[model samples]
Target: MTRLKQLRFEVFGVFFRQCTVDHARQLGLVGWVRNTEHDTVVGVAQGPEAGIADMRHWLREVGSPQSSIASAQFDETDIAELEHESFGVRRR
Candidate 1:
């Protein structure tokens, strides 16, 4: 449970921002999600092992509302440490 981790997902359409917000809150994760200019949404979540797992589950099950998710890609990474702040949508 000490391994570093990170998640990157893409949601196509206009339903990403809102859905991500709710999902992150439900999972008790702390990170930020934002929309790309290419019509895709991207996000990053970092925290305890259990919390991150819950977040992944939510995204996989119901992360988008008005948008039809074309695909999702995620992987683990070596982060120095988790951030000390609230998680929410970020302007990009």
Candidate 2:
């Protein structure tokens, strides 16, 4: 079954959101990422379990080369249906 994950990325530099969108697209995951007013990056990603896991790992360990990720929080939801057709960067 497809898995859905809501992720919040706390990053210490710029361009994390763009990197996130790129990574998600490359991973073939669907979701939307945006920069929060609180200086955090947030998004929801849904796809195969393995892709979700890879995204989680990337959020934690390997964000944009210009970004220093402070932390990543992931919440797995009961949703099994795809919510988005592609990954995108949402405007604040």
Candidate 3:
């Protein structure tokens, strides 16, 4: 079974796009993370059950190095297939 998880999160303290992308890829997800013009980070991740769990953990602890995540919301849905192999930082 495959799934698509959409996460809407806010970075308050200090977060960069590169670290965000690396974290998602390490979690074995496919999609992209981008810094919104509003200063929040929005991302979509698609992968297995445990993989997605890793991503969630990462998001929750993203600020230890220098970033502070104010809040995050994750919504999961069934997707027939994923459009990519691994998560990334999207231009859009």
Candidate 4:
């Protein structure tokens, strides 16, 4: 089953948001990621289980080499539908 997940990343430094977008798109995941007002990176992703897991791995382990990720939190739900066609970065 496909899964939809909302993820929050505590990233220090710059460009992690862009890295998130790049990684998601590369994984063929559909979702949106953006920087929050409180200085956190947040997003939602939907895709096959393996792709989703890969994305999570990227976020947790290889997120922008220029930035430091303090924590990554993910909330996942099994889904019967997908709401996004492609992954992109949003400005908050």
Candidate 5:
């Protein structure tokens, strides 16, 4: 848990914003997720390397039960500490 990372991601599909928030929190990540005007779910997740990897898999493969995920994109960076204090959903 010493290694931390930050990743910005966009997930295409529906009913994924809250799902993302729950998953991120479960992974002990700290970041925010929101729905875009384009109807995509977008957010940043920062946490341990392993948790990040798990989250990546979840976002890319397994999302909300009702969601029909078409695709996902991610841009990651190495970080020394978390930029967010907790994982959540944002209005913006």
Candidate 6:
């Protein structure tokens, strides 16, 4: 089953967006990631359940080199198909 998950995470680091996009692409997941004004990163990721799980772990425990993860929250629901074609970075 596929899933569409709302990803809201906080990190005390840089290369956050690059790391996220790279990981998502590597997992064959599609989503957009954006930097928030409050130093938080908000985005959505859609892909297979297994891939999603791996991404979640990377976001929560492991991020870019020297990146410190604060917290990660997800609100997800199963979907019949994916809604995005590629993962990209969004501007504020």
Question: Quick one: best TM-score, which candidate?
Answer: 5
- lDDT by residue for model 1 over 6-54, one digit each (tens)? 6666655546687787777776667888989988778888776776777
* Residue 24 C-alpha lDDT in model 2: 90
Candidate 1 vs candidate 6: which has greater lDDT? Answer: 6
- Tens-digit lDDT track for model 5 on 31-56? 99999899899999999999999999
Rank all candidate structures by their lDDT, best first, as comma-separated numbers.
5, 6, 2, 4, 1, 3
Worst 10 residues of 2 by lDDT: 6-15
By the TM-score metric, which is better: model 3 or model 6?
Answer: 6
Kindly report which residue stretches of model 1 are placed more than 4 angstroms away from their true locations once superposed. Answer: 1-4, 78-80
The TM-scores, one per candidate, come to 0.75, 0.83, 0.76, 0.83, 0.95, 0.84
Candidate 3, residues 1-92: lDDT per residue as tens digits?
45555444555444667787777777767887788777777777777767777777777765347676776667766666776877777776
- Note the clash tally of each candidate: 0, 0, 2, 0, 0, 0
- Candidates 1 and 5 compared by lDDT, better number: 5
Give the C-alpha lDDT of model 5. Answer: 0.91
Query: Each model's RMSD to truth, in Å?
Result: 2.5, 2.2, 2.6, 2.4, 1.0, 2.4
lDDT accuracy of residue 41 in candidate 3: 75
**Comparison by lDDT, 1 against 2, better one:** 2
Higher-ranked by TM-score: 4 or 6: 6
lDDT of 3: 0.69
Overall lDDT per candidate, in order of appearance: 0.70, 0.77, 0.69, 0.75, 0.91, 0.78
Which 10 consecutive positions of candidate 6 have the poorest summed lDDT? 1-10
> lDDT tens digits, residues 1-92, model 4?
44555443444433588888888888888888888776678888888778788888887777887867777777777777778888898777
